[model samples]
Target: MSKKLNIGLVGFGCVGSGLYDVLNRSNLIDAKIKRIVVQDPKKERSIDQSYFSFDINDILNDPEINVVVELINDSASAFEIVSQALKKGKDVVTANKKMLAEYQAELIPLAKENKVSLLYEGAVAGSIPIIRNLEEYYNNDSLTSVEGILNGTTNYILTQSNSGIGYEEALKSAQELGFAEADPTLDVDGFDSKYKLVLLLKHAFGITVAPKEILNVGIRGISEKEVAYAGEKGYRIKLLSRAEKIGDQVVSFVAPHCISDQHSAYNVHNEFNAVVVEALFSDKQLFYGKGAGSHPTGSAVLSDVSALKFDYQYEYRKAQSNGGLKYTTDAFIKVYIGSKYVNAIEEVAFYSVEETFQSAAYSFQVGWVKLEVLFDLNLNARKDLSLLVLPDSIQTEKGLSELIEKNLFIYENQN
Candidate 1:
């Protein structure tokens, strides 16, 4: 029999409130929100005031509260809350991806030292249950790569853009629908997906990598040219988070990629996320779910709470047995670069050129470029350029060439 959980829920935001509502409504788990700590106690809430508290120690000091669910938006403060909770001998569940990605190296050890479970299934792909799956199911599998649409806000915006909607308008709709935040830079600029990717790398490959070390290019500057190309090429533009193990080293990045309908993530859209995992024996597997929303994320947090009742904690089996796998940005990837200037495409010494398209309005080049070189270009190069990775299973010289040989490029001259 499992022990009843006394949960201290911090931050009554979307995910926090959603967890509260779900936990109260469901009898599936013998857990209750003993106390909720919020920054603004003055803010009106649907629940009674008796359940709320303004101090952190109200729950931390109370020995009865065994679980701390931190769902705050502020990453810095969240780190503090999680750290203190673990030190106080309370298991923690957090939905803040940024905090986890930034502080996993420190936090994970802290949890282990204190002998408490710190789970964050809600941090990565919302309701996907990916963290648990990677920890338990795929623990023994020799995973080669994990890639897919990891951000629903950008995915939703991109899906809306495909329906002839402008980027700003689509973003506005996502914001209004609660799929995106009021300030969408973290989503639009690709930082959110990048943070999630960091967590994925840890679980999928047992590698600890700083988020900044990964080359991240978000969907910030997506234009009609790329959208039109996708429509014409029968492809969908998605911000993909990819990490692949090559030999002893692993390369990872989060960027916008052009994917065809044959791909599993092609149909996943509008606040939905899909992750494709490739193992030596398993071949290919896809996990799809609602990646954003109050209830979806809350449900994930609730799931973590239930697990705590049974004393279920991740063992990180791979991390223990991992043979010093290295994380690297030093790689090569095939990409489609569209720019207003021809020099932008011609400037880089590409590994190999596959196809090039030119038009009166804009132009694009398809070729292989070194990962580090491309990462620097995206960071320091011209802001007007848009880079999209060409969808290919194998990014090797022969494999990329074979894939590109099957494509047809059409050059349009409006003059």
Candidate 2:
């Protein structure tokens, strides 16, 4: 008979507790939770108090523990804990995207050096298994683009606000329903999605660029007028994280986009997430599932733990390959710029103005503009301005497709 794997769990919050419950109820894997570390020992929990520990060393220093699972909120603390566990030669699993996005360059190599597994299936889109697919199925395939709705809180709020509910009220409803935190800045401000995009870059294109390098705009500035305008134009407003290979550069960004109902993203609503991977031979493949909630996220984390039983680890072949891919935010694109500050939108030179709408409260214009020029404008920084959506245009779409094909042909010929 196989020996049971001993686990040292960190954090007793939503995902941690859910993982404990799942482990207790399931008999699929021979695993046991030996210890749990949390911030507060006095805090009430449904699990037995005997399992709780105030110090992290109890888990990190314990020689018997074979696996360490970190699911904390603070990225700094998470990084420290994960680093320590890896250094101690314990296989590690975490659901913290921010820490991974920021420190993966250092952490990934460390794990490889130590020959310890560092798996994070719960980091990107919860319960989707997108990471595993990227590492396994698409490893040999030449991918052109990866785009998706990556956040549940903003998606839920956008769905509510588009249905005539006010923005503030929609946010309140999300908070009450436990879909959002009290301070929803990370999720609503696009930082959450940006972090996920950074991780996606590593797996999709074998690139690791900082979050600040990408153009990340959120749904916080989306108003009723913008939502109504999207509806009228046969589009749905969605916060999308997109990375596309053009020439030798990968254009990546996370922002609210106006997608037509005919598009697959329009069908993904509320707290659900969907990822579309476009490859050379595969064309397009969609991955959809519940993106948030304790059970869903916990299920992903448990999958990583189960994989450890068989000594599975991410190969990260693309990252190690000489892909010669570069990251850039210098693409020419089309966008809907809206604000009470009309002068702000008019400051840049547009290729062509598609339409213009004005009201007592705001003014908006749809036009073709260079992404770098728009990024220079910094519309997201202004309280009076908002870059509403990045919509697809016939000219821009055709141009990007051609560029992708040209780049792929060149890559193939060179190899």
Candidate 3:
């Protein structure tokens, strides 16, 4: 007969409402929702209105509320709520990746100083359990690289486009299906994936970097020609977030990549997410699941609540170790560039040209190039051009081509 844990939930949006339903319907965890804070009290909700409160203090200042779950969309408000909760010596759980990515360095230490646990398993790659796995199981492993398809909205749009639907139509369908928002900039423009990548870097490599410090390119400018080229070459166009350790340097970038079917991420489509972790001894391990949606995200939040009962918290082992890993964009790699402006393609000096194609609509070239040069170009900022994808054949300065070779082997070995 364990005592029930009291929870104060903020934000009764999709994930928040879903969590309320989940907690009410299940006896899996001995937890009760004590108070829920929302911005608007007049807003219609299926749940009992008596459980709702307009003031955040009702939950934060309440000594009986031992746990606070912040699911708000506003990062500033979320930061305030989470910080105050931790300061009050109450455990905090949140699904706000943006806030955590931007202020984790401060928030993590605050939680530690107050001796309160802070958990956000729902923040990145929803329902994948990646954060917990990284903080726990792979804590001792020497992780070399982590790459994945992290955004569900873009993935769903890409999946639809691959099926012969136009990009605009696919996006429209995603919005209608509630997979995307009216303003899909965050998801479509790579900001969502960028935030997730930053979190992954923290847990996987103990590297903390601002989202802007990493190269984040989205699929906004991708055309049918580029998609067709990928299909013709036995490759799938997937928006990929990748971080790799080369010697003492750590390189991370998010962009659309032309991955072959042999790659684990090739088949991940339509509101799904997948992460591939490459470690020293384990070789490669893949984690796949639904990236978003109310129920899946709510399930992750509930898991964190259950974990709190056992005093579970992130160890942050890599951050404590003297890993000497520094962020760098100087790594050499292969890339595909498509643009109506040929001068854009010719702007940089390439190491080698693998393939070239031309159509009335666009001209594309595949070649080897320095990552720094591409970062400097910032092709994502140019409306006239699209940086299609960085292929798996990328080579670094230290001549570590084993990943490419292994990828090829996997492709050839596949039935």
Candidate 4:
């Protein structure tokens, strides 16, 4: 049995409202929102005025509020609210991925110091129970790779683009449908997925990596040309976030990949998300659910609230047990680079070129390159190139020759 929860909700936006509704309507938990805090008091909302507070201290200073749920848009403000609440010995549930990604190492320790649980299943993959599973089940398994379509907005846009709509039109549709924000830079540029990936790295590999260290490329650069190529090759363009352990080091990145129909991610369209966890004896496992939306994300938040009732806290057992596993980009990746100019491909300086194709519309090459080279290219802000990571099977010379000789590799001229 758990104590009745008095929650101080720190936002009235989509997710906050959704949580409030579910908590009030459902009989799943003994929780109620004692007070709600908002930045702009004048902003029209569905709730009564008396339930809202203009000052965060109203909730932070309240002794009745045993739990703090932070769902604000600004990462800095969310961090402040969560940290203060934790210092006050209040259990916290937050959906601020950027904040957690940036300050998880510090925040996790703070929670332990205060003897309070800091849970953020809502921050990662919306409704997917990934963080909890990684903490509970996969922690004991020898996980080789954890990859998925972690961003709903980018996945939605890519789904629309695959249906023959242009990227701008797809983005506009996503925005209009509220699947994306007015300023969708975070989602479209892959920063959102990268933040989630950072959290996944911590839970999955017991590694703490800076979000910037990963090579994150979103579907923003994916033109119809790539979409056509994917269709021609019986593949779907999905923004994939992946972290794989190679030897003693772990390599992670977020980018657009050509997923075949056989892949679990191929059918994960719109606001859906999927995670593929591959382990030694466990083989492969998939977790799929709504990646974003008011109810979907709110359900995750409510679950954390319910968890807080029984004093559920992430043990971070893997982080404590795994030793000497470092995050690195000093790896070789098989990739397909498509660009309008051939020089852009040459500048990558791939260790080996497996295939090259030239045509009037675009030029591309499939080869192996040091992951650091691509990371540097991104840092240098080269804007004209689109890079796609190829599967590991084609990394060898024999496999590359077989793909080319069998006419399996798709090129513009070949079509």
Compared with the true structure, what per-residue lDDT tens digits does model 2 show for residues 389-411? 55553234457558657867998
Give TM-scores for every candidate, taking all chains together and pairing residue i with residue i. Answer: 0.93, 0.92, 0.93, 0.93
Per-residue alpha-carbon lDDT of candidate 3 for residues 1-415, written as tens digits (9 for 90 to 100): 3445899999999899878888877888899999999998668988788889999999988999999999999999899999999999999999999999999989999999998889999999998999999888887789999999989999999998787788899999999999999999898889999999999999999988998888888888788877887788888788999998888888898888888877988889899999999999988999999998888999999999999998778878898883688888777778888888777777767766767877676787887778777778876677777776656544576573565567668979995
* lDDT of the candidates, in the order given: 0.86, 0.85, 0.87, 0.87
Candidate 3 ranges with C-alpha deviation above 4 Å: 1-3, 349-351, 358-360, 398-415
Model 1 worst lDDT run, 10 consecutive residues: 406-415
- Residue 152's lDDT in candidate 3: 95
TM-score of candidate 4 relative to the true fold: 0.93
Tens digit of per-residue lDDT, candidate 1, span 131-216: 99889889888999999788999999999887778888999998888788888888888899999999999999899999888888
What global local distance difference test value does model 4 have?
0.87
Q: What is candidate 2's TM-score against the reference? A: 0.92
Question: How many angstroms is residue 362 displaced in model 1 relative to the true structure, after the best TM-score fit?
Answer: 1.1
Measured on C-alpha atoms, candidate 3 has an lDDT of 0.87
